[model samples]
Target: GAGVSQTPSNKVTEKGKYVELRCDPISGHTALYWYRQSLGQGPEFLIYFQGTGAADDSGLPNDRFFAVRPEGSVSTLKIQRTERGDSAVYLCASSSFGTGRVRNEQFFGPGTRLTVL
Candidate 1:
């Protein structure tokens, strides 16, 4: 199976708009995750999913940020009322085993760059 893939390599939007970023994890991967990276900073975890449910979403900054992995494969990160502070690279990752339980490394996508004005 292929590694994770994120659509729309780059996106630019005005403030207050809505945006959806997509991620397709490798086949058979049960664990999926989303992260945000700002310049000069490490990637920050946003949400994690096991199968069709979110196992952890504590890192999501606010209610305006959300993600879904309904089919346990393809996932989408939804952002509402976008702001300049939201500008960053959105990344998606996956592993064959669930987090905190597997010693295997997670595979990462190239990331989707989002810029808000």
Candidate 2:
């Protein structure tokens, strides 16, 4: 089975630009999550989707960040008006279900490194 994957393992951008990061989850996984990790910090949850609906997006910093999961599969994280502070590693993970009751393990992608100048 194919595991989750993310593109452009690395990215460098100027401040105030826009960027889009893509994530492909496991074929049979129904729960997908996006998180950001800053230098020397833990990964912070950004958003999560179950099927085609976003189950939680409260972690998104602001209007500058957005994401979408269509057809209950692949997802994309879009950032607008990027700032130097936005530089970080964006990680994607997936599991069989959203609820943790089943002891599901989250498979993590390599992650996309975004650097905003």
Candidate 3:
């Protein structure tokens, strides 16, 4: 894909259900990030992966939310025991993120809208 691509553009489920959101970053991008955006608000950082390891995950709300980038190119955000409060748009982004204080421009995906009822 020319840009970041996320699967299941929309997802709806009941509370307590588990959901997995997938993201494929642009080729050669070494950094991946996950975020959640609620109605009328900006995206909330969820996690950041440098290469195949999670460099930062403090943004996750709790243990119920997790993400992995096993291969360094694709990532999956798993939400367990979902709650109505979890309803939001999940966004994924990627960048070269080379060694430096300078942050590279991130390319974002369309996002997966998760609606919990």
Provide the TM-score for each candidate, comma-separated.
0.95, 0.94, 0.95
Model 2: colliding residue pairs: none
Residues 1-117, model 3: lDDT tens digits: 798999999999999999999999999888899999999999999999999999999999999998988888899999999999999999999988666329567789999999999
Angstrom error at residue 18, model 2: 0.7
- Candidate 1 Cα outliers beyond 4 Å, as residue runs: 98-100
Provide C-alpha RMSD values for all models, in order: 1.7, 1.7, 1.3
RMSD of 1: 1.7
- Per-residue lDDT tens digits for candidate 1, residues 1-117, read 567899999999999999999999989889899999999999999999999999899999999999998889999999999999999999999988655465867899999999999
What overall lDDT goes with each candidate model?
0.94, 0.93, 0.93
Candidate 2 lands at a TM-score of 0.94
Relative to the true structure, candidate 1 reaches a TM of 0.95
RMSD of 3: 1.3
| Cα lDDT of model 2 by residue, 1-117, tens digit | 478899879999999999999999999899999999999999999998989999999999999999999899999999999999999999999998556638968999999999998
